[model samples]
Target: MSTVAIFLMIAGVFFFTTATIGLLRFPDCYTRMHAAGKGDTLGALLLLLGLALYNLNDGFSLAALLVSLKILSIAVFIFVANPTASHAIAKAAIDAGVRPWTRKGGKP
Candidate 1:
């Protein structure tokens, strides 16, 4: 369980790092949102799951189970909310006439 939890935490951190890179490296808002939305959602879920597992490592108890469940619920909420929020923000950007990036020498 410890090993699994550790692996999950590491994976979550890796995704977060990749998302940070995407945010820094992407040329435009839409692409950056895509990276941030997907990476953050997955990273958060994995990290929360790891935390929940770690919480259970001491042995299963009613309180531990409850805490883990709460963590999972929060993860679920984030999974649903993040993408919806990202979509809404992207839509707003479109409404405001935000344009996608194009290469300088390429047909746009």
Candidate 2:
């Protein structure tokens, strides 16, 4: 694998790990979802891009093109869906009167 591909894979793994930690450690549902949605999308995109590049090292082929296209599709889907889901969740939470965390007295 090329150095760049390796770097991408490593960075993707790091982002994914940090996202998992954030999901486990964050104090609020919205915060956790934010971390999960954004970080996972970025990490998955990086990992997929790295894999596609590695595959392309064997020279241009139908399989390589297809793999890259699939990766791009996944990225696009996440780009469209993650924010929409986050917005829906935030709206539902607001409608239900869910309160944000504050440093003051921790009440509602």
Candidate 3:
């Protein structure tokens, strides 16, 4: 269980790192948001799952179960909210007539 917890946490860290790199290197607002939102949500979910597992392994009590459920709930919230928030931002940008960067023209 501990090994699984560690693996999940490490995977989450890797995803978070990838998200950070994407945020730094992505060409435009939409692309950056895509990288960040997708990677971050998965990374966060994995981390929370790892923590929940660790908690359960540490103690076999009702409190541990509650904490695991809480973590799961938070993960679910992020799963729903991240995409919605990203969509809102994209919609706002579109409504404002924000243009995408093109490699052959203007500032890309």
List the global CA lDDT of all models.
0.97, 0.82, 0.92
Candidate number of the best lDDT:
1
lDDT (10s digit) by residue, model 1, range 1-108: 999999999999999999999999999999999999999999999999999999999999999999999999999999999999999999999999998888897765
Q: Please state the error at residue 60 of candidate 2 in Å.
A: 1.1
Give candidates' CA RMSD values in order. 0.8, 2.0, 2.0
Q: How far is 38's C-alpha from truth in model 3 (Å)? A: 0.3
Q: Judged by TM-score relative to the true structure, which candidate is superior, 2 or 3?
A: 3
Question: lDDT per residue, candidate 2, 1-108, as tens digits?
Answer: 667878898888998999999999998877888888788878877887787677677778998889878877876887788778878988898799877766678766
Model 1 accuracy (lDDT, Cα): 0.97
Runs of candidate 1 with Cα error greater than 4 angstroms are: none
Worst 10 residues of 1 by lDDT: 99-108
- Lowest summed lDDT over 10 consecutive residues: which window, candidate 2? 99-108
* Local accuracy of candidate 3 as per-residue lDDT tens digits, 1-108: 989999999999999999999999998998999999899999999999999898888768998899899999999999999989989999999899989878885683
User: How many collisions between residues are there in candidate 1?
Assistant: 0
User: What is residue 61's positional error in candidate 2, in angstroms?
Assistant: 1.6
* TM values, all candidates: 0.97, 0.83, 0.93
